[model samples]
Structure formats: structure tokens, C-alpha cells
Target: MHVLILGGTTEGRLLAGLLDGTVRVTSSLAGRVAAPRLPAGEVRIGGFGGPEGLAAWVRRHDVDAVIDATHPFAERISFNAARAAATAHVPLLVLRRPGWVPVAGDRWHEVGSLEEAAAALDGLGDRVFLTSGRLGLAAFADRPEWFLVRSVDAPDAPMPARSELLLDRGPFTLDGERGLLARHRIDVLVTKDSGGAATAPKLTAAREAAVPVVVVRRPPVPQGVPVASTPEEAAAWARALAG
Candidate 1:
């Protein structure tokens, strides 16, 4: 069976690795990052021109099934993948990691968008640790705040007035995150609910430092798609369908 893995997350990479020897797997990356860690399979980077393009590619490649293991907050592409899979008349599965839930001792201000996050920063802090990724920095541009924006890639124009860019990858440790927060004197953290342990240490650090976190809620996944939370489960589902 041939599988198209729409991958840009840890789970996607893991699924590709798991199915590499078992099936003919082709992994597609969005190419948002300049230096993305590649999975162990045939990899294609960049967009497929939305749903129609993806559907065309699927038909051309004779893909039997598709697994969408994109970032939890990557709502647009997820929806496109669903529509594309439907258009191609193939089975589709979504492998989305669960969102983080605020617990006791956490100071979380949940917002629906980056604009709300920017607005929420008014009385929170002057120094901000912006972890909402590179795309949405424009929303925070007008806020009179000093931001330490961290992302794998540098963001574009219309950024915050007083901000320093920290180009780094994650899987950060609590010690490292704590130090960063302390050294920068970060009073507030702006982040998305892009869950998984890989980047959860920041939340711990924020809790420990008594820092208020402005979390942008994740957008809803596309409806009526089979969902898996782990690589193992996704592989099992694919195998069943392949059989």
C-alpha cells in the first residue's frame, strides 16, 4: 500500500519511521522551517497548492491512504488535507497531539487569537516571551511591549516595536526555560496551545516563575476524520486500512 503522510510534527515523523519498512510512505512537509528535521522516507517540501493540488498529487502518485500529522494549531492545512483526501477518494486519518490543559498554580489567560493575546498584554508585563511562532508576530506589532520572539525562523515585517529575535528550536528543558525567563525578566509569555512534552517545559517554567501566560487556543480540527493521538495508533490504523 502507498501512503501519503502530511507531516510537520513529531508524531508525523514517528509514524513515517514506523511505517518506512512496512509500506511505501511518502512524507510531505510544509517547509515552514528553513532547517526542519527530516523523516525517514521520501520527503516532499512546500505546499501542494491547497486541496485541489493535493488531490491531483494524490491521484498522480496513486496514494491509497493519507495521514495528517500536522501541528495541532495548523488548522488550515488540516482542513485542506481532509478535503483533498475526500476529493481523491482515499481514506484519511488525522494524528493530532492533544492540547495542553491549565492546572492548579498556572496563570493562564486563554484567548482565541493573537490579537486577543496582544490585547491581553496591556497590564500583564512590559517584557514578553513570545512563543506564538513566526507567523503571527504582526498582531503584536502595535503593542508597546518588549518582546523576545523565539521561533525556528525569523519573522517578517510589522513586528513588535521593541523586540529581540531568538532563533532556536525547542524540546526545551525546565532549567533552560527557567533561566531564559529569569534572565530576560519575562513577566508574561505568549504562546499557542501546541501541546506535547517537547515544548511543555515552558509552561512549567512560567508556573515556577509566577509568570502569566497568554495562551492562544488551538483551532478546531476538520470534522469527520479518524483521529489518532499517538504514532503507534496511527500506524495500526493505517495497517488495518492497508490490509
Candidate 2:
């Protein structure tokens, strides 16, 4: 009953805790984050090469089932997991949290992709609070707006010409969110619809302050895989496979 989780998220860590003692669990992280919080059980860091390499690993390691519990915006790995699981002839489940939805009085401008979000920012505001991850800063590089870019790691070049980096991680507080918005005088916010409460306070603060938001929509999971919306539900799926 060995289960391999393609995980680097909060739900993935929680799922490892839920199944730690009951079965043989192994969590795989992408190693993008410098100091990622580890889950219980065996852990492997770095890529599995590609889908073919991942399928080979499954065969070599005798993994019984595969669970994809990656970040919502992690498009490449999700598709790779789907292909690897199918090739390995194992049960696969996609543990994806739901995307964020705008509430009443929220000025949300939703876009299909990062490029579109970047384009939408032109009409939104000049002082931008961009929380759309470090790697994506290139999309906003050519825009004239001043950006307050936040990430756990400092972003590489090709970012906005007038951007200041704010290095931080989250589970951010509402008070802090309010303070950041006020101190920076941010009139527009740009983020991905990476759902969950860890960094959701910014959206709340944006709504209260009457700031416009440009949200990049999350990419879809593979078409045929079964999807679970929570760690508990994903754990149930694993338990059924174990039984």
C-alpha cells in the first residue's frame, strides 16, 4: 500500500499527516521553494525528469497509487502526473482546492492567463501590488506601472522596470494586509486564483479598501482524472485504494 503524492502544498502536507501511520506514504516536492515545510513520511525533492521517468520510478518503487496535490497554478507537473499515473497503471486522484470567487462589491477583473492579467493591469491602476509568484514577473515587465512584488524568493530579471521586491511568505493577517495596502498606496492588486486561506486576507483587504484586482485564472486539471477538493476527501480516496 505505497502511495506517492506529487505534493508541495498545504493540503498535500495535511494529507500526509492523515495517512502517515496507516500506509506507506512518500511525498515528492518540486524543490522550487528554498525552504519548504515538509510532510510526514518519506520525502523526495526535485523533478522526476518527465512523465516517462516518473512512470519508471513508479514501477521501480512499486507505488500502488498516485495523488497530485500540487499548487493550483502548477500546470506542467499536473499534466505530467496524469500521464505518469496512466502509464504506470495505477489509480490517480487530483487533489485540487477550488479557485477563489469574488464576493459582492469586489472589483475583480478575471483573465485567462498571466499575460492577460498583465494586459488588464494597464486599465486597472498605476500602483500595483503583484502577488502572482516570482517567476511570472516577466509578464508585467513592459508595463509602466510601479509594482510591489512579493514572493518568498526574490524574482529574477525581466520584471517591471519600477518594481520593488517584498520578500515574505504567508498565512498573512488581515491587519498586515491592510497595512501593506495603505503603506504602499496600492490601488490595483494582481494575483492568481490559488484558493485557500493562507494568503486570502489580501483579497479581503482589497475589497474593504475599494482596490481593483486582476486575478489570473487557474489552469484546468487533466480532463478524466477524479478530483478531490480537500485533504480529508483525498485521504478517503487513498483509504479506499488501500482497502
What C-alpha lDDT, on a 0 to 100 scale, does residue 177 get in candidate 1?
Answer: 96
Please give the range of 10 consecutive residues that has the lowest summed lDDT in model 2.
117-126
TM-score of each: 0.98, 0.99
Predicted structure 2: clash tally: 0
lDDT of each: 0.93, 0.94
TM-score of predicted structure 2: 0.99
Residue-level lDDT for 28 in candidate 1:
97
Candidate 1 local distance difference test against the native: 0.93
Tell me the spans in candidate 1 whose CA falls farther than 4 Å from its real position.
Answer: none
Candidate 2, residues 1-243: lDDT per residue as tens digits? 999999999999999999999999999999999999999999999999999999999999999999999999899999998999999999899999888889998999999988999889877789999999889788888999999999998788988999899999999999999999999999999999999999999999999999999988899999999999999999999999899
Report lDDT (Cα) of residue 141, candidate 1: 85
